[model samples]
Target: MRVAVVVMETSHHRDTEGRRHIERLAATLNEAGHEVSVFCAQWWGGNASRFEPDEVTYRGVTVEPAETSFCTRLPALLAKYRPDVVHAFPTPSSVLRAANAGAKLARAPLVVEWFGDHEESVSARAIGTANQFVTPSELVQTELWEAGADSDLTTVIPESIDMDLVRDVVPAEEVDVVYAHPLDDSANIESLFLGLAELRQKGWSATVIGDGPERDTYERAAADLRIDDRVDFVGSCDRERRLAIYKGAQVFVQTAWREHFATELLWALACGCIAVVEYQAESSAHELVEHRDRAFRVTTPQEIADSIVASADMDRRTVDESLAEYDHAAVVEQYEALYERLVDEYGLF
Candidate 1:
């Protein structure tokens, strides 16, 4: 099957979970013997020079960059590519609308993936335009349904991890506590700092990963809390380093106030880290580790600290079985099945 993936950006444009998700899907589809093409914008984060306007093969997938004014370019590209199915990410309204028009022009079935927590009212038109809807979490599906999407057409396909990259290299009890998230305001870094401060007195150490605008502020807070030595702020490393941290971490701490889908938390769990997520209405992290023995859902900084301490003795192997459904191969197979069904049903010959 020839598949055309439409998204605003990819990992080439920015290193984000959503873009990485698209890249993984495209790569996996190509590896499965399908011809996959990615239609995306050239300029992401004002770095147009980084990507050429011409088409290029990236990781076994053909990537065709479009103009900033994608509305005009997308339909033509779609018509020329003539893919059997067009999979689009619902974001940046313009891109979604463009993909919708392009899919119609190409006479291909449109599948819109609702990956982020977008307002249903604002996204209703895009959701309605697509032939099928795909979401990584039930929370997103619920939002789409409430926004007037056909519940029968919407499917929940969780984001998956490459199991080959995730393995228990170190026992959980022998590893240190680790927290990884952008040091932005939404991350609620203060809570983690407070919790770590308390844990430091008990002779515990933590490694804080990721970088953002608020890094200095968080660093100062760590200094003020007198736990600066106990905390290591190793900002923004590559994937290999990040995975190594997860593999060796005893407890993976998530202090974010909200998350549509906590990809980092899922990675840590798959790497055999005891997960602890701060309870939030919008967070889907809890869904991944429903078993209390594998995770702890807490409400306060104190509780987070306590949970981390308790995780020192819990067996990390308990969470290993829960991650099987999220394996990369399994998720890719589900997507392939969905594509085949949609293509046959729509008769996109």
Candidate 2:
């Protein structure tokens, strides 16, 4: 099947969530043996648009970059590609509208992928497209139903992970704890910081990986809390380097306030961090960590702190066994089935 996936623009420097998601999905379709192409708008951030390479054929996607709008961009490209399915995972309202218009122009089967609340605002504007909705978690499916979509037409397709990349992981040895991402409120980063602070006071060391808008702020939070000496802010780390960090981390922490898939948590598990997640009841984080016997979930920083301290002394073999569920091959197979379903639905020839 000839499939044309569309996105508003692409930026190499800051490969945002959607960019990475699109590349992965397009590759998945290609892996499923479908002819895939990407039609994109050329919107370079903080700079005037310049066209050097408008056509890029990579990852089984023939990318066509143009300065086109919803009225013209996707429709014009679809008219040219004439694909059997027009799949668009729009990141924003305007962008999704453009893709919706483009899919209509192509007159092909439409599938809207959602990682968060998209259909809530876009459904009324979509007019009436016979499009199936795909999401990585139940939260997204519920959101789509709330947005007036037929629940039957919505499917849950778990995200895929490239376990091969994590295969060389040294697997943390004696490290007490590991926390990726910056210290922020939404992620309950403050809580994690406080939890670590207490642990540090009790003589535990944690490596804080990743950077964000609140780096300096978080560093100060650690200092103000008097746990700075116990925490190491390693800044951002590429996966290869991160695998080595994971090698010694006995505990993995993710404090995101909300998550559609909570992917990094899985990666941490793959790297041998006994996963600890903090989430609200309604969050998708709760959905991902459902088998809590394998991982622990808490609602308060105190709970997190207490759990960490209690679990720190947990048996090594139990920790290792718990993380086995996230092995890359197992996760990838879930995605493989999802792609197959999409292909079957569209009859990608």
lDDT of each: 0.75, 0.64
| Candidate 2 segments whose C-alpha is farther than 4 A from its true place | 11-15, 43-70, 91-107, 117-120, 182-185, 317-349
Worst 10 residues of 2 by lDDT: 54-63
TM-score of 1: 0.84
Model 2 pairs whose backbones collide: 1-349, 171-247, 172-246, 172-247, 172-248, 173-247, 173-248, 187-255
lDDT for each residue of candidate 1 in 1-349, tens digit (9 for 90 to 100): 8888887566666566667677677777777677887777554344332332223332211233443466677777787788889888776666778887888788889998777654323456666788898888887778778878899999989888777766634333334688888878877878878887777658787888899999999899999999888788899877767778777678888878767788888878887788888877777777776774678888889999899888877764413655777887888889888988988888845
Residue 272 in candidate 1 has what lDDT? 76
Regions more than 4 Å wrong, model 1 = 8-16, 43-69, 92-94, 117-123, 168-174, 316-322
Residue 349 CA displacement from its true place in model 1, Å = 12
